[model samples]
Target: AYTVRESTVFYVRVPAPHARFATDLLCEVVGQPRLDPADVEIERGVILGELDGALDTPDDVVFMNLVEALFPGHPIGRETLGDPQSLVAMAAADIAGFHDRWYRPQNLVFAAAGALDHDEIAKTIDAHFDGRASGVRPERIAPGEALGSDKSAQRPIEQAYLALGWRGLTATDPDKVALAVLNHAFGDGPSSRLHEEIRERRGLAYEVSSSAASNLDAGTQTVYCATAPEHLDKVRRIIDEQIEAIVTDGIDDEELAVAQGYLTGSMLMALEDSSSRMSRLGSAVLTHGRAIPIFESLESIAKVTTDDVKRVAERIFGQQHVESIVSPDGDEFDDDDED
Candidate 1:
């Protein structure tokens, strides 16, 4: 059982005579057990293959490029799966140390839910973790370097995926709710601004939308579109033009009302699922030290004004913010030319 701010993940693993209690337990041993170096190499190879698989997908590659640009110097910016060179450079000791530092009892929360008896789970956890000493705090990681280059490529993919992004408000900012509502209107679902402008009106691409990334320290909002090789440059220009329009004329009353309703509806729907509720609780705990009730978030969304959305957009989508472009190997069009 593991408990977060307002949620929990309970686990009950039966230990057997020859079976290890946990795989990460190896890191807890008093001394470095003689590990076969060959086995480590094999595992590294498997991970490398997985990285290759992710890169092979166009959408994944584009999003990873965005992350690299958005979080240039940060660990969160670091690929979830480290790059080939980075993985190859890792020693067995490094893996052991990382596991020991991050997987400690103090860093964990035991939680249980559903029909399970709380006392029995608590007793089991106490039996297993009672005497275990807390580990040292993990070292803080630095911010990722911001994306600067106008163009990037992973050549083998067939389609071109592009993103024009801007830095946004942090999760705790008062305008976060406003920003979410704005983003929903701009490009959240099929009825969004980008979808209406780029896909429906002009047939620029098969898919187009915008989204926001929110966290305790910072946040970002991006307008993204995908088009075929022949239509790439036009799609980029259209996206930029639409963004400029949003910044200038501001949104109309009708658009604002639509965005408000859609955002409110989405929020209401999100809470209907148990897993989402649990996730909401856990994320609040992780990000803000406690969970914010569902009603609290809904109220925030409902109260957002058009002026608030416009102000957030102006602050977030500034000219100086980061930009990223990823294309297939030998494209003639240059993303930097637009700058």
Candidate 2:
């Protein structure tokens, strides 16, 4: 999908011998989509339904709200499933024009994984896609100020969903590895600090996790939690307290080692599958303009020292944060963004 903060990736996987056929098929579809008016209306209905379903889920709603509040005026902040009114107003001719303007050769990339002859595939691509003259990629949306203020909505639900987000390093930032280590140690899994404190010890939240999203030019680190409406205050406090402690005390050797191993091991394990490899290939290329081997990725993780993690933790978490709350009254959390 085309997005503001990240590159749009088109990917497909096929058996070794079927790679050429798959490439040819994808080109035909992209270069000449059958945009019948009937088909357009049908797809619009399907997409709108999916979007409506996503909004009903508390967590999804909270996350989408956070993205909107964080990247205001940017393409990333645009409605996830496109605007309902816009879709309804759109015509088949408009869709075709939009496609023609943006679906240029320069904007697309061809990538494959698994057993295949690179030369043969390249030749096949040239034969099938030749004369599809290269054109400029879609203009990247420049970022504006992130709305660091807190935003809350009244949802009349049993559980409250909260997301606390901070600006993060770009994909190629030197501290990216350290940031990954910081994320893993904070709340990536059951053993993470957020889970250990928010769920295991306090029994406050039913779900809690942290995520790092990096794009070509901008990035974010977010912590998500859902708990009984009554426990929302405690959950929010503990999250802030834990982050402050990390910035002040830093991570220990044991914690740092665990994070490094987990990060590297996960990368290694994912590469064993063709689907993972294909995704990694496309995303890596889009982010770094090249594919980084698994070993190189592991090495990068291994080199993230304790100090690196500590410094990055302080730098990222110390920024003004965007907080989002979805609860019955929108009255439980602070309206002011916290640092």
Candidate 3:
């Protein structure tokens, strides 16, 4: 599968015995893809359908609006699947040009995991991608200050969708790990503050969660929920209170330990799979310029103190945020509609 974000990644999973074949196929696909006009047209139709589907998904609409509000005119805020107009205007030549411009040897990293001979794999890769001319890596422009805007979309759905987004730490920030821990304790799972308070305690919403996505140069921390339209105000108010409480009082020792344990355990468990390990290797090198040892990452999580969490919380949550909502009420969603 391939993912397109601030960066584009193409990966394949194969048995160890077929490692060589996978390497050749991967290099060939990345290096000399045939952007056939017919194929491009077919994929264009597929993507257009996806765009339409996204519009119908309240969850997608809410977060898309939130990101746009957070970054405004920046590319980071733009929808990853792109808008319908742009996709329609695009052609095979445009795709080929993009591939030629960005898919350079210097801009690529090769990573593998599983029972494989490193030297042999390297030799195979070198043979497949030996003396390609290197091109300049594209320089990225950092996004300007985030906007604190409240935006909403009207839908015919019965449940209201709410999303809150803040400009968050970059992948390289020292406080990123702390932010992760805070996310877990604050809104990541059922044991999180948001889930326990909003769902378990108050029964305001059935689906509520928070996530942090840190990219090479930009990041976002977001809280999302889907609830009955009548409970929208209560849910929003609860989310705000939780954020304020975490920022002010901070998490206690027990909460910190629980968050840390969850993070560490999850990491260890994920790395057990070869595909996951390979992804970790490639993502680390692509994002941070090195494959950080798993042990070192675990160590960082282990050392996180409550002070660290509080400090990072202040750094992030103290900033202005963008709020986006999708509900049946249109602009009147925030009015006294809550019963």
lDDT of 3 by residue, 1-339 (tens): 556567677888888899888888988898999889999999999989998999888898888888888888888888898998899999899999888888888898999999888998899878866787788898899889858467787877788899999999898999999999999999998899999999999888999999999888889999999998889888989999999999999999999999999999999999889989988998899888999999999999999999999999899899888788888855475532111
In the range 1-339, model 1's lDDT, one tens digit per residue, is 333212234333334331233322322332234445677789899889988888776676666767667766675555667788889899888877765565566665543223345465556555656677777655555454355454466455567788766666676788887777777777888877788878898887888889887765656677777778788888877777877877776677777788778777877897775455546665677667676876787778778777887887777776465555556667764442211
* CA lDDT, every model vs. true structure: 0.66, 0.81, 0.88
- Alpha-carbon shift of residue 33 in model 3 (angstroms): 0.6
Clashing pairs in 2: none
Q: What is the per-residue lDDT of model 2 for residues 102-153, given as tens digits with 9 covering 90 to 100?
A: 7776776777778987898788777766887787766676577557456777
- Give the Å shift of residue 57 in candidate 3: 0.5
Q: Model 3 TM-score?
A: 0.96
Error of 2 at 316 (Å): 0.7
Model 1, global lDDT = 0.66
Assess the local accuracy of residue 86 in candidate 1 as a C-alpha lDDT between 0 and 100. Answer: 88
